[model samples]
Target: MAGRFFSVFSRSLNQPFRSRLQGLMNYGLSCCVNALLQSFSATWELVDLLDRWNPVDKYKESVPLQLRKVLLAMQSDQSQPAPHQDFLHCLDRNYIRLHVQQDAVEVFLSILNLIQQQMSDKALAQEIQSLYKVTVETYLQCLECTYIESGTSFLLSLPMHIKESHNSLEDCIRLFFELQELRDRDNCYCERCGEKKPSKQRFRNSRGYTRKLHCKVTFPETLNISEILTAEALSQSYVQSDSQYSLCAVIVHSGDAMFGHYTAYVRHKKDQSWYYADDSNVRQVSWEEVQNTYGGSEREGTAYMLLYRRTPEGKQQEWSSG
Candidate 1:
């Protein structure tokens, strides 16, 4: 009897509320009602004030120079707390603004000078380097996303502190070069389709026991391998009359130490990976050995070499040079 009475009382309380909720939802006024109901709370009032005065950008652009000067000073002296109170008050709104301000030559120079004053603190220099890289990457990404062309060259222009104990901005720049290349190579083309070689058609060829592929870019050399083999291997099972030649070149991708070891075969004309030449013998092997084993005579040009490799998932990949 008590259970039945409670069920009836519950339905009595919920039915009208349920009806009102259904009506509000059907009319698409639920959200408006919710906002009005939430207005009773302080949090909602704060949000309302923020919405009414979206002045974040204004605050950034209007930062007092006196405070900035103090920051520069503190940044220079590691013994001092970098004045965070005034800055942190505007934290969420002013971060982007502060970052942009820091990009200014004057601002950066001030900070740089401050950092120079604390040159004895190797840890501090390393910290600054990390911050510098993060800033550059963040700026680069934002520019790329926004399609802003101007700041793209800023990375090449920024002066950074070099420390013997830490990897500097130069190292990051080199890595960026290699990464930029891989990004450039994200597209692929099928070699079977050809009509005068598309100005950049790719091809595949075999050299000795290895296969190679390449982009049909011209190189600066040629050779006759079998004619010189007696001077090389002493006997000729490994050397064949029709043995194909491969040539490779070292291209420093992005003006960094990371070089593209390009190798490709001349006869069948395919691209290859660098793994074939990455050997103790191969490294010790001279250009003469390269010529005698794979090179063959051509009228006035040099034969190319290509290298091939198996990828982590068992796919074939190739890289070429010279």
Candidate 2:
């Protein structure tokens, strides 16, 4: 529950479970998880990787197993009650309590880490990880000692700061990789001088986080982050990696800090159309309608989290149901 981490941990505020989540054997009263489930079902790549995992022994309390099951159930003929009743048991074992407000981004990260840590097949798990992995190189330089240490790391969800009034997703992503001077509380330790000192920091590549800002953020249905990758990140790739991404899911948080609701705009993999999933109720929607979540006030919803898929250059997106 996002506050991994979106700042609105109170987004759930222990709210009532919304709509028995597809009116099936829903997972206790967690609309947050319900919304997340919708997004997960939309991610065909994740489903593909999870489906490939064949473990020698299956653990009863495994989150990935339960996730795989629930995702599969979600795709079954909607006429029958989906087998999500056991979802409650899985959450209980993992201590992912219900009836609580959780941040979407935070939950997203937690689930990703759970897959990484709990998967029985490490190789397949890494394949799942690579789908959302955002690799970056961090350069840290201490001002006083002029000692510099650089290392490569990766973020499952790149956190970016948004503007108060207006924002463009690209600009925010650019700023995420920009240089920053750390001082005072943010100062770093100087290895040579054996003391703390102000340091300059920069990231080679990255992206943003949500802070419940009631502002307008403009984004595209298909996103190309190639231009936004920092000079260092681009150099490292240097025409090797494709930078195009397709928006697959959007987790929307409606209402304000005290209380809220969670919904999702998912682009169906096979159907190739947007659909608004509100627990038990799901309806077709347009890209323009999806943009309504770009927040202008606390009363309305804003995109709390997003899921994008990397698309290879010059290739048509995977549109088949297989």
Candidate 3:
């Protein structure tokens, strides 16, 4: 029966078998292509509407009217075509665009606030943190853009410079101390005069030693070396001291550099003013031998390597974990 039916149907078509098969395939492909085109047209229309819609006025007024028009157009009458889906899609696109613009505005305001230090001034270091927060939010907005990965990473890294700037300064100071050369000379004092002339004392730490003679008991306003020659002189004076090298490292928690606490290492030498130790020529010696022997005992800690640098204004501060 099936064979007979196929014979009759084939005769009725009045076309070759391959031609009929090709015709069916072409019809199916056309349907698929048409569906794809319709969907794309719908999406493009939505994008166009979002691009033109004004959230503050035009769009707000048009949305309700558009929805009502779409519903009314869906009447049983065959003459008018209803665009219910397109109207809804347009509404959603407008909302998403508005949200994106709002986020961008918020991020821009935050950047300005940081410039003004409104996050709270130097009395507390909250400003750095607030600025960092603003930076992160900006990065999130970029994630919604086209060039996501690199753009986001670049923005995120901008705030990280605050940490790097602090770290670089500490490293430079440590290097200077490690390469500092101190001048040593003997002192003769009159014991008879309770006008007792003060003896020279050398204080050694990571950088070099401070020599305080009877004449001057305080640090100089600036480091005594000239920039160009200082490096060379420091190279000649680089002595590996067994005295524990004191360095400063900033502690950052939750993307914030904690400036409230500080750590320092101190060393004491016989010549209290400033002079090099005898066996300071080797690199990486035991902690006890080169450790800043004077002040570390006063502070409580598991004793880690310390890095120190002058503050921004070149002021010397005795940083306490306090």
Candidate 4:
């Protein structure tokens, strides 16, 4: 069944797929959510999981229920223009207001949290949650003593802080895992020292698996992390088959930090091609077009959130089978 679906999906990509692709109506400044929905549609794994959910009642008020409906409607051959109005209303009812500028990364995290909170099926909810979970172990070493504190936590999307100057996706990712010195006023409280003292903080991958990072920093189309991650970090994880990742989706923000519009460039999974989606219009694009979002220029759209998939090990597979 999966193979058949991929075959059809691939054919659609090669054809006038944009004509069949439905666009969301921007009701009261809904471009942010609309852009996100485009990326969500591209993430077929998420859509498949959402399809398995069966909500008995209270569907109108449930975020996941509304999301599932909207995604399905968007992919359908129906003539309805504004299919995501209910999903937007559902979000508004859940306190994510409309007619306001939103940060894409924050909205993405909120959607994941909503799914974890509102989904009725426990196992399915967990499956959805695990789809983007990034597990890391944070270590805090006391400077005064040798006492070290470690804790394991999970992030649905890793947030990388960006610098003012030019930066690469690989640098930002490595910086996220790099150790930092916390000294003077920024000291941590040490139980052994019974006082605040200088310390070092670092994080490493906890287990072997593929994870997602919604890089807040601007990133190029192709990202190679072979030289970024330290050997120690890679040696600790068995899932580190390859250190290369291809851009699957890019959530773009245009204008200043205070006010902006959001759009997305999503790559079709089966065909490995790019498409740009802005509110109600989507068009086929190339790799050069995707690089335009790297953002070092003025009055141009900048990449606000990035969605990358690990490159598969075998030459025949474009992406990981999982």
Candidate 5:
């Protein structure tokens, strides 16, 4: 019951990471997909899931097939490089067109959906989906009749909103679950009373544009979101499970919406060493260096998506800039 859910998207102590990560060549403005692949490489859990499954159809145009091959090829000891050309081509055929500045989250979700749709093994495909699922319950109350309706919902990722001023990750998460009251023009039709009435949505839940926020948002290397869990979500949980999340990988963006560069700071699965992957260049980086992505200006690289590993273990980060 450890709400051990991975979100789309934490500090380590002193440890020098020198493991050289294989870099992907930017084939036809493939930086966006390259960054995502780097992040996925760090997700050894996902790699293992795909490894356990045997694809019935090995079509070149199939996304999951290409992805499985690429992921396995990445871990190969063979000196031959694991070019993602076929994977990219498969993606292009799937309408994730080549040579376009793609949004990382959208691409990430699309990949997940494609796996579910295209994979022959339905059980294994669902196993992959359960790895990143977030469970929540919503409560809606009508003001006029005092009628109430509640339902459970699932989410794959959480999007954080940045303000013009200071921001904190904890505050952002709390705000996402904060109850909202709808009044005035915004009213819900109550089924019991058959009248439009003000309502309160208790429980709950970025776009684009080239405009960048210069706000300084503070995010932690280790996070525990159990405190923000709604009473309903918490009630269903009979076991007191650990919900601490450790920082694993972060996708950083630098530039406007039209023209931006994507890079990833990923933690090695075997060694827990941090490495930075930028297209064809791969270099070891420290935890502090990863924190630099917290942007206070347009020039500073901003964290686009963060990947965390839920753990019962305390922060075991050792900091030593290599």
Candidate 6:
């Protein structure tokens, strides 16, 4: 019966049997990686960049190399059931353990970091890193003498702390940029004053563009930076144009922080349609159904990591039903 079905299916060229969405088999406890792979698949730019890499002989077990292979196979029309097993094994050889629960955010960052460390092409390596790099300035201001010390740093992902009560993504982001007063035991040693003094620790300047929110924060399907930016942030040198971002992918956790399963809802780039991908099972979904992930109730999944893409100015955002 299976052979007859394949024969008939192959013969119907006019009605081609092409799958719009493909699934990856769950090997051991690999749902987390599977979810990430769906998001990575949605990001075609990353895939194209990875395709250009030509690594030397030393780094054969490179994560990016195996990842490129797996992504290509997953997108192909092959008959293989488990195309990602070898990629999973490669990650295991790199010390990302199999059969163990993993944090989606940490694993995602680890994969990018591995690409940075293992890729032989230095120029292409930095290009991949710049895709998600967020630059910010940290400053320490002394209260007694009005002295300030500042430094700049970059983050691959912005980690925001969530409140126990209801929280919005914009509020969480605004609070992350807010200045905090440090007093008493938290005072810093002043160089000119030569003693411990009260001060303020705050982010001075930030080049906020595309960002990843790492918390149980509820964000809208479309996010505008017009309201989220504070007066101080607006006055900074890096703040240029207010950009609008659309939610492209979400990494969801079903259980508690300690034990959970990972899945993803990724929006297609060409069609702008939503698709839910659980390990080895992929299905088309609606925008309203995607909203069901907004946490605040029981038995529903919370968003662990969010992926947003900046919408180009003057272009209409088209979201069509699949």
Best by TM-score: 5
Report lDDT (CA) for all predictions.
Answer: 0.24, 0.70, 0.23, 0.72, 0.74, 0.72
- Which structure is stronger by lDDT: 2 or 3? 2
Runs of candidate 3 exceeding 4 Å displacement: 1-310, 313-322
Q: Write the per-residue lDDT of candidate 2 for residues 1-322, one digit (tens) a residue.
A: 1111000011243765322113243444566787788877766667777778786657877888988888877766444445665665676677776766777777777888888889979999898878777777778888887888887887888776776778888887777777788888777887887888888887432236533568888777776767676556454644644677778788898877556788888776655778787766767788999999878877778898877777777888766544
User: Which of candidates 2 and 6 is the stronger one according to lDDT?
Assistant: 6
Which residue pairs in model 4 clash with each other?
none
TM-score of each: 0.18, 0.84, 0.14, 0.85, 0.86, 0.85
Off by over 4 Å in 2: 1-27, 144-147, 203-211, 230-235, 238-240
Please give, for residues 19-73, the per-residue lDDT of candidate 3 as tens digits: 1000101121122211111221212222233234333333432443343333333
* Candidates 2 and 3, the one with greater TM-score: 2
Model 1 Cα lDDT, one tens digit per residue, 164-234: 23332224223333212112333222233321121211111122532222212222132223333333222
Give the per-residue Cα lDDT of candidate 4 at 272: 68
* Candidate 6 Cα errors over 4 Å, as ranges: 1-19, 58-60, 77-82, 203-216, 316-322
CA lDDT, candidate 6, residue 188? 87
**2 or 4: which has the higher lDDT?**
4
Roughly what TM-score does model 5 have, to 2 decimal places?
A: 0.86
Candidate 4 per-residue lDDT, tens place, 7-28, comes to 0132343554344345677899
The local distance difference test score of model 2 is 0.70
Q: Candidate 5: where is the Cα deviation over 4 Å?
A: 1-18, 77-81, 202-210, 228-235, 313-322
Query: How do the residues 1-322 of candidate 6 rate in per-residue lDDT, one tens digit apiece?
Result: 0000000012244756544456788888999999988888766667678777776754447788888887766655554443888789889999888999888888988998998988878899898877677676887889999898877888887876566677888987787777887888789888788898998876433444533332344678777766677666544665334356778788888887667799988877546768888887777899888877877765788777788766665686544321
Better model by lDDT: candidate 3 vs candidate 4: 4
Question: Which residue pairs show collisions in model 6?
Answer: none
